[model samples]
Target: MKIDEAVEIVKPHLTKSRFEHTLRVADTAVELTDVFGGSREKIELAAVFHDYAKCKPAEEMKQFILECDELPNNLLDYHHELWHGPVASVLIDREYGIIDDEIKSAIYCHTTGKEKMSRMDRIIFVADYIEPGRSFPGIDEVRKAARYDLQLASWMALRNTIQFLVSKNATVYPDTFYAYNELTRQINGGY
Candidate 1:
């Protein structure tokens, strides 16, 4: 699907703030794709559809997943925040016929990230975190690091996320730990 069409489809599902954030993420992903030598089209498509299932009611998301026999067992225990990205990926693939692996992977990992992330995965993850509309603490530093150091920026962003989760006493998803460890290993290896 085209970026605009994807935006239109997801627009009604998001609040004004989230819709704006999505647009910013799309634009940021495009810019990062240009700078980092990835696929701009894939990045934009992933960004536009990344949160496609985010605002769905919990029961609705669960019901949709239950109706689909091929859904992953890994998704069974996800709470709302953890479920949204993968659920959105499945919905985008099924509903909009967005079947690109890079795009799907970006959407799949945008929330918590994963080990051995692709260039597109890193782009989408950083774009979502450092998008212009996002205003969480330490975002400015992440955005600044993104301009010159992709690996460092990813480490900072993941670190911030881990710290935030710890502060809130929120559950730390396994993928987050995997991503953090992978990123830490990369940084330590002088990447």
Candidate 2:
């Protein structure tokens, strides 16, 4: 589906602020695609729908996951933010017939990134964290890194995420550990 159509479908599900953030992420994703050499269409679509399940009632999201058999296994153990990405992926595919592998993978890994992310995944992940509307402590640095080096920005963001989760005593999803390890490996010349 087109970006406009995806936005229209997502509009009702998000708060006004989140809807605007989605637009910024889509725009950012497109820009990153041009710079990073990925399919602009896929990046745009993935960014537009990355948070499609964000505003869903937690109970409802959990119930949907319980009912859907194809949801990822890692999501089943940590059903909090862990389910958001995979659930959003399923919803975007089922509701909008968005079948592009790049787009789907981007959405699937947007929340808690994976090892060896694709260009589209990096774009969506960084865009979501460093979008214009974001105002976190290290956002400016992340935004700058995103412009110069997508992988570096992602690694920093993942590090910050893991630290934040640890501070809050929040459950760290396995994917977050895997993502951090993968990025650290890349940074350490393990590739």
Candidate 3:
């Protein structure tokens, strides 16, 4: 679907503030795509719908997460905040016919990134984190990292994310750690 149609379809899934954030993420994803040589269409779709289930009632999100046979069952034990990514992918695919694997995986792992991230996955993931609307410590560092190096920026974002989750005393999904390790390994010499 076109970006405008995607936006309208995604609108009801978000609150006004979240919708604004999603817009910034979509715009930022475009920029990242330009920088990193990714598919703009895929990145836009992933970014626009990444947060589609983010603000869903916790119980509702958990229910969807629980029912998702494809998702790792361990996710059921984690907090609902992580449910949005996987659940959003399912929702968009089922409701809007957005069944593109790249877009779906991008949304699925946007929150807790996977070890084997595609270029598009890294773009949407980093774009979502360092989007213009976000205001957090070290954002500028991440933004700068994103400018010239996708792997570097992804590592920085993942590091910051892991740290944030740690600070919150939250469960750190293993996929997140795997992504971090893989990125760090790639930047360093080798395994």
Per lDDT, what order, best first?
3, 2, 1
- For model 1, how many clashes? 0
Report backbone clashes per prediction.
Answer: 0, 0, 0
Q: Compose the digit string of candidate 3's lDDT tens values, residues 102-152.
A: 999999999889999999889889989998888999899999989899999
Worst 10 residues of 3 by lDDT: 64-73
Give the per-residue Cα lDDT of candidate 2 at 22: 93
lDDT, candidate 2, residue 50? Answer: 91
Ten residues in a row with the worst lDDT in model 1? 70-79
| Pairs in clash, predicted candidate 2 | none
Q: Give the poorly placed runs of model 1, Cα more than 4 Å off.
A: 67-70, 73-78
Scored by TM-score, the top model is 3
C-alpha local distance difference test of each model: 0.84, 0.84, 0.89
Comparing 2 and 3 on TM-score, the stronger one:
3
Model 3 residue 39 lDDT?
84
